[model samples]
Target: MDEQNKNLILATVLSFVVLMVWFILFPPPEDTGTPTAPTEVVQTQDGITVPAAEEGEAGAPSLSPTVAQSREQALAKSERVEIETEHLTGSLSLTGGRIDDLSFTQYFETLAPDSPMVTQFMPAGTSDAYYALFGWTPAAGSVPFDQLPGPSTPWSVESGEVLTADTPVTLVWDNGNGLVFRRIISIDENYMFTVEQTVENNTGSEVRLAPYGIIARHGEPTDLKGFYILHEGVVMSTDGELAEIDYDDVVDLPVDANERAAVEKKTVVENGWIGFTDHYWMATLVPSPGQAFTAVTKYTQATDTYQTDVRLPVVAVGPGETTSSSTMLFSGPKEWETIRDYQNDLGIEKFVDSIDWGWFFFLTKPIYMALHYLYILFGNMGFAIIGLTFAIKALLFPLAYKSYVSMSRMKKLQPEMEKIKETAGDDRMKMQQEVMALYKREKVNPAAGCLPILLQIPIFFSLYKVIFVTLELRHQPFIGWVHDLSAPDPSSILNLFGLLPWDAPGPGSILAIFSIGVWPVLMGVSMWLQMRLNPAPTDKTQAMIFNWMPWVFMFMLGQFASGLVIYWVANNCITFTQQYLIMRSQGVKPDILGNIRGKTQADSK
Candidate 1:
């Protein structure tokens, strides 16, 4: 194919890939949903009934707790209810029955003052997973939780309500005495405790019930203050059944409730179960599946602790039939010694589903793991990235070297090939045959250069994924003005001088910006250096076409992770050094460097 056509084809393909990546990272808002679907449970004659549609809606809860006023007032009144035990020390709120504050001042560092670090779960409002019902709704009035105008009247506290140190107190609410509610508190060496909420309908009639629970946040979810982590585990069949489901093979699970024009969402898990976060994490799971028509919803979060809320929406029962639902709440860390507290495999680790890599995972996973370990060990992700890239380059050295040698040989034979082209003049078939025959006799492999580049493509993709998702590199620091290598570069002279986006960073930070800005410059320089060290295409079109390749690559790479950019920068530098050494060893003149001797030699030539 002619150089013009190749460039056109490559340009089209590049544009398409860019669009796809843009959409993947910044998907349409409509695509977001909760992790768990709304659950609907019904008992059939043969077994349990669960409608997938109902389950889909489990995440979209329109009902929020009735606030006395607005969220600002509630937050202002968030009480610091402290509980002391050898096993646990934290503060919760009596107002929202949530952990409004947590401190291990003597146990652990303060984390931070404005840090939204919670001792209990605090779900991200923007994330489509485990959405918590808090803040305030229209019914509570305008002004959000954070923007509430001012404090409102305090909520009335009933007398004799105290969270004391003694036999653990239990919080109970029953419909027997017009839905009486009570609070019980306790302390112990073992903070392990079980909360059993029993709801029985005794109005001599069936009444619909929606079980809702609330816990306060010592902090809210924020991008700046989250500890990135994952859960891993397996699910076993019925009690002692011994049968297990391989949760390793990932399936797309719901992140939030599906919203439809008129359809109701539901989810049903017949096998009663529980869940636990990693060892340091604690959680409370409330399972309340009411009568035949009950729809139950479960959600959880993590801070310094974990809070799981189970919402049960019950429908009417037959007049004569007494209906009841029970929920067991387990709250504690997932420490091996304590995880067993919430047995039935709840404590078992279940890794979050990740994107698959086809057959490449077998090879890429080890590389990723190695890089991750190094990142954690050194606490400097940029260095780890450099090391990983170097390892990959070393492994592929033989192939790349052969490719370079082949290209060099091709360049040496170019004069002869051009003579044949001139002699064949317009006889395309004859020219092609001559070119093939020359390649055959010379023992040249046309594909020798292509294989190495193709092999590197997958490796590049694999590393991209690793850098993008590996939590270990999230906030890791690096040396000399470049800290938090996982995030965008934090230093930018252009930005400092107001010539760029004030939030804009140096080349390593924002992938897209860096690609469009710094990548092209580096790539151009690298490619120019490479060209000077080796063959130059005879055809002006081919030379011009190849000259533009680096710019195209730079645009493509600019929007990649800072770690990836650093790797490329190192790769280019190393490649330039290698090619320069090769040219020097081959007795090639160094006119490209423009030294006084080089200039004189070039002038003489």
Candidate 2:
């Protein structure tokens, strides 16, 4: 094979291998038998034992079936302190003083205007019970569990009629002993909530207790995308390092023969946060930046529950003294600006890293930032993406120009190359040597064309990551039939572009392979036209591979987000224009019509 053909094949094979490995490593979840029951009692590193269920409280069975309940039914079970803010609307449950009911006022479950708002936290007693609970755990011998407010403890609103950015709410619960516990909950204009818990001791002696926060989820969310690119499970930033544990990984942790559950804990001596992250929303517990804390992630086999906890240092409350500890709760969309603000302004370490930037974080972060700024400038995400693509192309224009110039030179030397091949016939080594010498004399680099193509791979992947994972792209509109740029093109050729009433195949289905969309088809055509800028390869195998590659890519990427498809199509068209103009400027006109006719004749022959 020629050098150029070899380069092409190598790049194609490498790209294919990378994609295959990714798909293999993160296959879709498979159906499994019911999970076994968790043990009755689960112990943490802090020596606190949590029971699977309180007496007479309805709990999930050992092999319980997946059940769902209405949001109203779940909220009606507990008295709640109403939560209202510019960006959030929910309530704080009186039982356990958990910030359990939360919905983002700005986001919805679907693109439809009437669709329900996105609810991030759900109170217990519901099928998908998830919430954040904060309280104190007495030292080993200091006080019993009943002495402190437990999960079912009822707290009364002592101050503030409603929880808002300006008006904070305080819940007070007297332990019916010498100790009284008060929690002051305050929210910002965004999603951050500051929870301060204070304990006043009136007894004669001192009491030692450890303050902790727990975020518990009864089971995996039914709406989980389960895509490998996005994380939908435990995410923690401890000290300076970040760790992510998927739901399956947590459930598959090694269990002792005597233990009914598995738990993993890490001690962070400085800054850290722990929580659960959905595709676009996250609820994390952020402790004070300079304090030492023990972070734990656990999965109970019996209850089928996933929990993350941060246990802070033990505090001693002396008689007639008051002790207070505060924690920040983040529950809302993972907007880059908002998260970065928390990281920078709130002093949360690596808080912005929670967005799951994947392997190409360096490129993805900047790409997303540029897209965000352009969106702000243009007031349209679709235009922002197009502008970003144009900017990237401009930035790489030097290399692209050099590549096209070299390609034009190579085309000009085609006659000389043919003469050398004929003179050195039947001697492969001699022909290669002559070709090399000729290239040197002509100052043409055979590898130049590969540079632009090579550079595009990383940019393409980073753009895909940005579009697929960012909340800003969700429900964003472009043009006709493209209400959601983050989703696949809704106009499928199979349906005659909406002329037919039938819908395209659902994602990941077997028939989805053939469910090509309009943007993908356009991308394929652009790629084909770019390839036509040069004559068909003389080698039959090379020509055949080149001919089929674009269609294959079209189908392979058919289900990708429309925004990414648009970028690819735009890139191809720009590349074609550059190559055509450069070739013409070099006084060598490309015979695209002749090339097409020649290929058709070869096929007929």
Candidate 3:
């Protein structure tokens, strides 16, 4: 094969390799069933907080190794202040003054009408005991753990009965010996909560304590997606540096001998937050914007806890002095618009990074912006994907135009090139020299045709990552038979599009790889038709590769997000039109139909 054909085949194979190997290498992590809730119990305090590293060296508070109660039973352990906001519902446990129970009022666990609201935090005793706790950590040589309020501190309502956007709740606990603790929690119309924790010291001596916020997940999330592309673990921003540590990596964090847990700690001067992020929802602790704090991530295998803590600097209170610390807690869905608003309005630096944009952020971010606007304008994700494809195609139209024009010129040179080959016979050196002279004389480049294909590789991968963003695409319906664009195309040919009584194969079933859905089949056809715009390769093996490529991708990607499949189909159709127009402008009308028939005849022969 000529160098041009060789490059074309290599590019095609490389694209195939990337598409196939990515999923193969990084298949979803195995689901080792959510951290088993403590099965047996002795003192049912829900769960105990593991001792901290030290009073001075702040570390995350995690569940202690012990048995637990069910979520309802755990919630019942403490007197609670009911939380009711526009977008959130749940209660704050007065025991720890912890916002341990919350569910998104706007979202459901599934598309079904009866599906439960999506729960973001569960009480300490639940199988997935996830919660956010704010309290005082005593300074060195200060009061004992019991003296200051903790995860299990029993506080009584000091103010509001029900917590609402307009009505904030206050809980107070007095040590009686010398210190009194009060937590005033106020919720916004959305997800943010302002927790103002104050401690009044009435003792004769100086008292010192550090305020902190802890987000603890008793075990890995029960609803963990475990998908490689999606991040579901400890996601934090320290001094504007974003870090996404998986649950496995959290477990592997360096040991903090003082804390007796695997810990990673960072001292952030300002502009940071720490939290656990599941696929769609997140619970993060954002220190009062300008406040410096020690951010820590911790994991304890024995207790099966993953924790992130934001510990503020130590504050000292003189005799009869009172001090308070205000912090923000975000516990809700990761809506791009909402997070972006928080970042822009409240100066939550890089808060949007909590959403995994992946390595292709350069492309993914811009593509997501375009797609996001399009979704809003069109009011349908399917159309948004197609609109995104068109916007991208239009942006690259000039390069595509040049590529197609070059391909036309190369086609014009084919006849002369064949004569040169005939004249040179078996003299390979002479044939190459003549071909190079012919190309240089014509002022044409053989590689231009591959630029569009080369560009598609990154764009395709970026869009795939975008679909995994979840909030925009999850449970979103596209045109018809596509209930969830983030999920696979549901209608399968194997079930004759539901004509057969049997249903399509489940996504996890091995047969799902071949359960070609309508969208995937249409995508394959679009790709095959696009290939027909050019004459088949002269080499039988190369031609065979080109012929089978579409079908190979169809089978391989049938299980990908249907939104991506729609993008591919749109891209193929647009490309086909562009190439055809460029070909016609060159006075060589593309006979795609004839080429398809000719290929069939030749293959049959």
lDDT of each: 0.41, 0.79, 0.80
Error of 2 at 342 (Å): 1.2
Cα lDDT of model 3 by residue, 306-402, tens digit: 7788888888899899999999999989999999999999999999989999998999989898999998899998999999999989989989999
Clashes of each: 41, 3, 1
When sorted by lDDT, best at the front, the candidate numbers are: 3, 2, 1
lDDT assessment of candidate 2? 0.79
**Where does candidate 1 stray beyond 4 Å?**
1-72, 76-349, 352-365, 421-430, 490-524, 527-539, 576-605
Q: Is 1 or 2 the stronger prediction by lDDT? A: 2
Could you give candidate 1's per-residue lDDT for residues 117-201 as a string of tens digits?
Answer: 3243222211211212211111122112222100111222332243334545444333233333333334434533333333333
Query: In lDDT terms, how accurate is model 3?
Result: 0.80
Q: Please, what is the TM-score per model?
A: 0.54, 0.89, 0.91
Encode model 2's per-residue lDDT on 95-149: one tens digit a residue.
7888888999999989886999999888765666788888877766676667786
After TM-score superposition, the amount by which residue 483's alpha carbon in candidate 2 deviates from its true location, in angstroms, is: 0.7
- lDDT, candidate 1, residue 131? 15
